[model samples]
Target chain A: MEFFINRSYFLNKITNVSHAISPNSPNPSYSGILIFLHPDMIHLTAQDSTMAIVTEIHPGELNQLRIESTGHMIVDAKYLIEIIRHMGGKNIHVMTVGDNMIQVSDENSKFNLFTLELERFALPDIKRPENEIKISLKNIRTTVDQIAYATSEKDARTMLMGVNFRSDGKRIITAATDSYRMALNYIDGEFSQNFNVTVPVRALQEAARIFKNDDDIIQIFVNKRKIQFVSDRTLIQSTLYDGTFPDIAAVIPKNFKSMMELDASMIIPVIERGILFKDDGVAELRMNLSEKGIQIYSGASTIGNADQQVYEVFYQGEELRMAVNGEYLLQAIKALKTLGKVRIDFTGVITPFKVSDPENKDMTMLVVPMRSSY
Target chain B: MEFFINRSYFLNKITNVSHAISPNSPNPSYSGILIFLHPDMIHLTAQDSTMAIVTEIHPGELNQLRIESTGHMIVDAKYLIEIIRHMGGKNIHVMTVGDNMIQVSDENSKFNLFTLELERFALPDIKRPENEIKISLKNIRTTVDQIAYATSEKDARTMLMGVNFRSDGKRIITAATDSYRMALNYIDGEFSQNFNVTVPVRALQEAARIFKNDDDIIQIFVNKRKIQFVSDRTLIQSTLYDGTFPDIAAVIPKNFKSMMELDASMIIPVIERGILFKDDGVAELRMNLSEKGIQIYSGASTIGNADQQVYEVFYQGEELRMAVNGEYLLQAIKALKTLGKVRIDFTGVITPFKVSDPENKDMTMLVVPMRSSY
Candidate 1:
């Protein structure tokens, strides 16, 4: 393979594809990036067993890309990126020097990197699925960020480690639950057909990173085995989990014993301080509401105690007290801070409570209360 | 104890004192900060046996410091700082609420922190030594930064973990070494009495952090057992290590077979990239200097090889080749990058080479060449 390209432009492509490269991948082929140089374009591919990322660079887009020969080489991803990034020159020259070595050089530095044989490289099979759904990057990113945090980090329940995306020809609903809490987001979109798939939370986060602007629309192609998020120059494909997600929509209660509205800016800092006094192993916090306002308190036998009061909140229904996981509530409140104000509805001491933005009705966050010996 | 102070100002003082606190201290008294409130000023102190930092806040310095009642309290350093820093109000009100509890409150939050009994608190003894020497903060800080990196991290030779500061009533010489490499710095300062002390590198680092401006002069109070760095509002006292530093000045050879000069900006980046191909367990780099230029190269059997050449250099030495630890050379070169150009003197392939700024004769860095199979 021989090519001369702008150092910075090539470095950006390597970094985008490196997102999927796992250093500890057992297969030697998976540890390097496969660079394919065609007559008009260059494609960089990197993948682990479960996910793959491919980025393409065309000659017309960047006038600096000058192709000398059409060939392919799989170079160690880590070393390749480091050499390219640390080089001082504006352009880099890459050419095959020996049977299994390629020379990457700039004005001052030259690196001879060993390349993996093409016969051993495990190239990912990428195909555009027949069923494709188009959605704005802004809407999809919001949906993923709102619900992905609630996914289970533990592998006990493999399905819970992913966020469930289900569409019914009219609206797309996403839900994530780690048993203790659940986050759900609903968005209106036109769908080609009905589909439900659980994509790994980590994969969704990586795909969300490709959304740089609200104006760029992304096309997501899905099948029974894999789902791919396709952008203008990049594509991220992830495999699906093989279990059914729990039916959690039935649990969103319609009635509550008490509800309160709070300014997100006013309450987030108070909870952040109050949680510092939480018990050593448990983030248990007690919140009380009355006609005056809301009060939150937490105490650890060895670490002292903290109390914070917000007197500007608007409360209705009956005065209530509930024990909750402070970290969960804090995260939900922080995520909703962009909405300015949020409303929280509580049923009883033992039931789950719901929090939502008063201005937006599509996003809902639910948390189960912990038992307190008050 | 009851007092109200500006939250931001108090937080800054707490943070400064917290640098000396160790969380896993065996003595409970050393884990908390002792706050002493006198009629004129308030002093905050935190110590971990070996090092102590005391900062004083006077009423006039910060007009927000209002002494309602004069008393003292010992609170957990970590918790106290967190609560004070997270509070939203401009001014924080602190008052004793119970026998061993103090209520630290702002307009929105209240924290009842458990304080250690004053009797158990190990108040650091900070008495200015009789022998006092004044030095610019800039000079001392520069001396520490230049030599501290060469100090031994291993405890096998306890004295090598400290930097030796010796003065002959006219000039102060600082030297630090871990056997393989040594860094020496010389600065002129007037002294009332001749003194030689080896202070722990860790302690010196903490003391150096207090030097914010070049114009500020710091007083060093030294005695047989302890050394203290005093500024206007803060004082850092550390116990002197009980051992004698080696006389390394005799080891710096004045004779050299070859010498070369290179631009710091040009060669530092080359070495940084060449070291990427270093051996797995060793940062071994090979350098060749001749009439052509300076060429550096390194290789690992499994990670490939890299070569970097610096053409813009003035050489006065015969053809020479040597192998040295890349990381050590890189660090010394990086530290001297501020000096535009650096001169390197090589005695032989196996002898210790020296690196220094051609303009500044006071600072010198020497590294031993490693044995390598060509």
Candidate 2:
């Protein structure tokens, strides 16, 4: 394709689309980015088979965009990005050099990169025919961001590695769990039809990056095997998980024997310091409740132990001692970053404890307590 | 040992000392930092067997440093640093909790770290006698910085991996080479004794870090087997390279057939962009001189080539063309960062070429030209 466009605008859009290309795709062409130059707009697409991202560039938005020739080609994503990154000057021209070769040039440097056969590259069939759920990009991002961390990256049960999206014509719930911990978030959205789809956590994370703006409206379209998230100029389609997500209400404890409301400012740093004295590989911090407050400690045989007393907590019921992975606790606390107070509910020692923000009832985190000797 | 000191001050001094603690040290105690609480001051030492660093913490610098028990203890460097880093509030107290146990506590957190046996830790014997080369830390750092990049990290020729320092009671010369290229820098300093010593590149780099101030005086003491770089509050001694360094003056061309004076700002980015289109593995950039300025190009078989015209270069003599690794050229340019203009001198097509800053006559670079198939 032959096109002359603003160097910076073209570079940013290309970079965002290039992230979808899998680094180690067996099919060489699948690791390439498809660039299509139309009369009105430029279309860029990259897919790793599982997740695909497409960004549209309108010629009017750029400093100078002129389509000398209209065509399509698939080029190596990494090589194209590198060439543009180093090619200096304010304005750059990208055009077809020869058969299956593209030249990107500025004032100082002209870089010619060989392209893969366009016909060999198979892009995912991504489309949004009719939307089942219509949600603001801001709400979608918040729901995904709060629960994405709880999803397991490399679980044998593939369903646990994805974020579950469940809608019932009115309210939409997104939940992610890895057996050890679970995070659930609720978003108010209008859904015309009932839908349940599990999008891979990585795909959601990558797709959210495209929705950097808050005012963008996103339409969610679901089929039997794929789900498409389409904004104004960006569309991302991800393969759906075949298996069902774990029921969140079933795992959460119905009744808690004791509960502690802790200040976010007080508990975060205490656990941070206590976690420093944690054992290798497994970071376990024990929360011991006394009449005074909560005494948190991390123990080891050779590295000694760290014990800190947290003052700002309202504890009731009998004295309790529970242990959980320090990293899990820190993540949950950080995920609910804007919360003024964090409420932690404990049910016995081995039972899972739930952490939630008092201000935001929509977000909840359940962490399975580790087996403690003390 | 027991002492109460400012948390940040202790952290900074310990972190500096911990750099000398090499991981997987054969002697377990060697991996631990020895904290000695003397009656007047605190001493910290860490040794990797090859290199040892000793830093003194004067009592006057701390808010309150009292030695209740004047003794020494060896504690794991990484663990001790981590504990102090997270311990909240200021004015921390470090004391021997029990036998072979150290307790560091602040207002919020109390960390107990188990210590190695004090008797087993053996520190390096480093001392400075009457007369030696005493150079300003700034000058030493400048000389090392200019030539240090030329040293090979894993050269079979061991001496090529170290920076050679030579003095003739007038000017101190520092040179490093890896057979492919060489960098030499001269510093004007008065030396009482004529000496020559080759210090390992890693040691010079580590020693340079301890000299954070330009005014700090660096005293160089050399024995047959060890070279000690003693700065204020910090003493770092490293084993000497037993091999002889190559003569840098011998490789530098005495006469030149053609020369080009290139602007640092203009030439650096042009070569950077040209190098992006370089051939696989080795980056070779050809410098072609025509009646019009200088043309730099980097080529590849399938990826095409990048050719850029630089107009700010002043050319002389016959039209000459030579090839050199782009990475080597970039490193020499970056190391002499203060120079506004860089001059390139060439003797022939395949002979060694020199790049020197026109403003700084003390620094010189020698690059062996590649056999160009131009």
Candidate 3:
């Protein structure tokens, strides 16, 4: 392929796709980026069997593109990235010289890199799937941001490693849990058919990064084995984990006798303070309510302990003392945007506790309490 | 011990000494900070055998300190730092109760931490050495900053892991090298006696961190096994390496046939661009000089290559081609201030290259060329 592209534009496009290229790919071709120069645009594609990313750059601006020929080649992603980084300018000249060599040069420096035949690379099937879901980019991103962190990273239990996306015609629900703490986000959306699928947390994260325009709609094609997220000029395809996700909704408590309402930001600092004393592999949060205020305390045996500044809150039922993971509580509180208050629901010492923004009832975070000896 | 101190003051003092506390100390006492509350001031000390730092805070500031008693104890450094960080206020109340328990509390919360007995912790002896050398803090910091990066971190070659500080009654010289490259800095100072000692790089780094006031004089007490640096309210003691430092002055080239001058900042970017291609371990500097101007071309095989924008230079040689470690060149250039011009002296391909800022002749960096096949 013979083409001249803007150095910055080419660098930006290459970087977007290079994140999917693993250095230790089992397949040598996967370690390279597939570069295709068509009549109008240059397409860069990289994948590591799990997540694939493709970005197309138009060569219309600044007379950035001069295509004399159309061809395809897989060039070493790492080397090409470094070359473009050092080239340093708006415009760069790239062309195919020998049968298996790509030449990238600027005014002062030139590099001739060996390339693999395009036929050797495993290109994913790009045909649109039969079952497609259209959703607003902002809604999907917000849902993912709110719940993705709760997914388990360890694959010992393969199902917990993915976030469950459930839709039932009227509403779309996203739930993630690692058995200890679960996050559920409910958003308004319409689905013609009920669907339940588990997408790996990493795939969701990559999709979130590639989908930047909030106003644009993201088209998701889901099948039995693969899921594809498409935006304006970018497409990310990932293989779904073939495992049954646990019923996270069943674990969320539906009733509570004691409820306290306090500001999320104010409560977050208290939880963070409690985390300071967490050592010996355990983090505990102790909450006590009195006529003065709500007091939060956290302590670890081997490390030190912390007591947080109390905030005035309205409490009902008997005064309670519950212990839970400080980190989980902190993460949940940080996700809440409106600083007004969070309603904390407690159901005795052994039951899971629920925390939700009082202003928004659609989002809920549940954390299972630690077995404290006290 | 009971006292109330400003949170910001205490935090800053603790942070300065926290770097000396070893996270993986075999002795638990080493992981804790030694607190000594005297009549007039409170002192915090932490040591890990390799290096020890002591900082003091005085009472009577913003009604923050209210001393009730004077005592000493050792509290966990990590936990204390985190507690203070999360405590969130200008003032913090700290007190010791019973034998080995410390309490740090604020307006709405209290944290009671278990502290180690002061007798169990080892505090380095800070007695003034008979053959101590006093140097201007500003001079020492400048010298250390210039040469410390060259010191080897690996203890396999113990001597190379320390910077050699040599004194000759009138001038103090500091030299550090990792065999491949060496940095030497000389500062004019009056010393009562001639001395030569190899101080560990860690000690130099600690000294640089604690010695903030340039006009303040830092007294250096050097014994057979330890080197002590003392400022007004801080004392940093470090163990000296027990190996002979090589005579690095012999490696510096005495004369040169070719020289080129260019701005340090201008050349730094060029080296940064060249470093992107430095993964293959070789950096090539192809210099072409004529009446027109001077240009530098550096490239690495694994990273990309870069051609630097030409700069007007006073050159006194034919076209020169040499390959040196890009890191060495970058470090030397960064050491130069806004008086940005750097002078490069070349002897031959086999000899070491010397780089220095024309404005400051006291500092010089020498880098050995790597044999390149290209």
Candidate 4:
């Protein structure tokens, strides 16, 4: 097989598929990308048992192309991508040297690599599910960004590394928690079924990257053990997590005694300046709400103490004090950046506080407060 | 003692002296910046055993000041600088809280730190030498920038960690080498005496930073064991290196059979793009000069091979091939960034090659060629 492709164009196409290539996988075929050259098209495919990605190059993208025969070869993803990335000119000439070796070259550079036999490579089954849901890639990106960061990345409980997607026939709710804080979003759309599937956060992140435009339509196919996302002629299939997520109603705090409503812009900077000892291990800020205003205090072992008064806060009920991680609160606040005002509800010093953006009422952030020492 | 200074103004003044305050210094006193709150002014001082730096914030710079008593306190340099950097208001209040503690506060932030008493802090004895050389900081910076990077940073041969300074009552010759490559600069200027002193590369780099302007006149006082640089109301004293520098003439190649002159800008990019296998341990580029043009070749075990033609060279050399480290050549080219065209003189395959800019005749760089295996 022989074909010609633009260097940069080939690099972009290979980069997406190469993400699924785990270099140290026990299965040698999983460590490479399948380069399939057809008479009229060329594409690359890679898989890491649990997930698989495929990307194609259309007919008119390359400068020139000639295929001696339709064939496929598994080439090391890293070396192939690196060669094309650093190739001299725009056009690249790729050809099959032998049954187990391929040569890729340009005008002044050439690379030959031993490839795995085509029979040994396994591409994940990506047939459309019984009931596929049509969703905008943009909406998925927003929901993923809002909830994925709260997932437990290093937790040995593998299921916590994913975001729980629960649909009750009409509305779909997405949530993520690391046992410390929970971020939940109520997406305004209907899904196919009432399935509660825990999709890995990494898969959601990769899907977000694949779907560049917010309005682009993407087809999501779900099964008992796998989910496939198809968009713009590319397919990303990941395995479904095999554990159950905690009940959202039980995890979210409901009642609060004292509530403080403040301008979102005013509170962000106040927290940034007030929490001066951020470089130390865990960043904590104390919030004391009075009838007049709210007082924020933070101190570090060596870097002094800070006390800032924010008169913009509207307080109700008796005086209340709560201490929470400053960075987590900042992130939860930034997630609602488009909103004009933010409201924080505190029940007691030892209780979890709930934060909500007045403008975006569909989403709420629950922050677990640390035991106060102040 | 009490004083009020602008936050940004205080940050900049403290930044210079804080460099000498090595936080992990063996002596606790060296980790703090001594704040000498005089009746009319306040100055900050910091020192590691080998080096000391002092910077002044004069009386005119502050908005207001009321010095109740004249005393000194050694406050932690890092914490003090961090507090002033993130201070809320324009003016910061600095005062002595007690016998061994200091307080720095503003409208929204307050910092208190335990300090080393004035009696325990050991200040280096700084005095003007009998004879000192008056030189433009700009010229010294230029010379230091060109040669300092060539020295051995962690080599057991401590003298190689510094640049050699030699004078003949008229010209100061500076050179540095890491036993592989050598950088030499001959600066034409008058000096107080014909002395040879090896100044640590770190000291030269710090002095270059202290003297911001090239036209600023700096007095360099040299003694048997220490070198004192007084510039712009700041004094930086560093212990001079106590050993002999290798004879540069014996190290530089004296004979060559081939020479090539090329535009430095053209050569830099050609080398960068032609040798992309840089992530591997050692980068070797083979330069083959033919009657037509020069062809550069580079290859790695996994990352393929690269060959590019460079037609922008003026060559009268025979058919010769030499392998050299690409990064070393790139660094040498960068050192001559201001020059338009660069000339490289080569002797043989094993001999070192000398590179010089046609415009800047004062500096010369010699790069050792690696022995070829292919």
Q: Which residue pairs does candidate 4 place in steric collision?
A: A138-A214
**Candidate closer to the true structure by TM-score (higher is better), 2 or 4:** 2
**Model 3 chain B poorest 10 in a row by lDDT:** B300-309
Query: Model 3, range B1-374, lDDT digits (tens) per residue?
Result: 88888898788788888889878988889888888889878888899978889887776554466677898889988878888887767788899867778999888888889997566686777676767777787877776677888888795879788888897556888898898878888876666878889988777777777777877778888877888888867888888888778777766888886888877756665667666655546555665554456666665454344565464576777556666677777876776554568898888765788888888787888888767653
Every candidate's chain B TM-score? 0.95, 0.94, 0.89, 0.92
| Residue clash pairs of candidate 1 | none
* Backbone Cα, N, C clashes tallied per candidate: 0, 0, 3, 1
Separate DockQ for every predicted complex: 0.74, 0.68, 0.46, 0.37
Tens-digit lDDT track of model 4 for B1-374: 77777777778888888887666787777778898988777777888978889876666644444455677888878777876776667878888876766877776556666676566678777876665766788777976778887888778788888888888556888888887788998875557577788888767778898778888888888877888888878998888887878878556777778888888867776677555664357778988975577888877765455667777678876668888898888888888765488988888777888989988887889898887774
DockQ winner, 1 or 4: 1
- Please tell me which predicted candidate would have the highest DockQ against the true structure: 1
Arranged by DockQ with the best first, the candidates are 1, 2, 3, 4
Q: Where in model 1 is the C-alpha error above 4 Å? A: A61-63, A117-120, A247-250, B61-63, B117-120
A1-374 per-residue lDDT for model 3 (tens digits): 78887887778778888888777877888888998988887888998878889888776765477887898898888878877786655687888877877888776556667786576688877666667787787877876778888888796877688888878567777888888888888876555667788888777777777777777788888877888888868888877777777766667777787888777767777777777766676677776665457777777775556666575677786676666777887887776666788887887776888888877888888888878765
The DockQ of predicted model 4 stands at 0.37
Candidate 4 segments whose C-alpha is farther than 4 A from its true place: A22-31, A61-69, A98-102, A112-121, A249-254, A273-280, A300-304, A338-340, B61-69, B116-120, B140-145, B188-190, B249-255, B273-280, B338-340
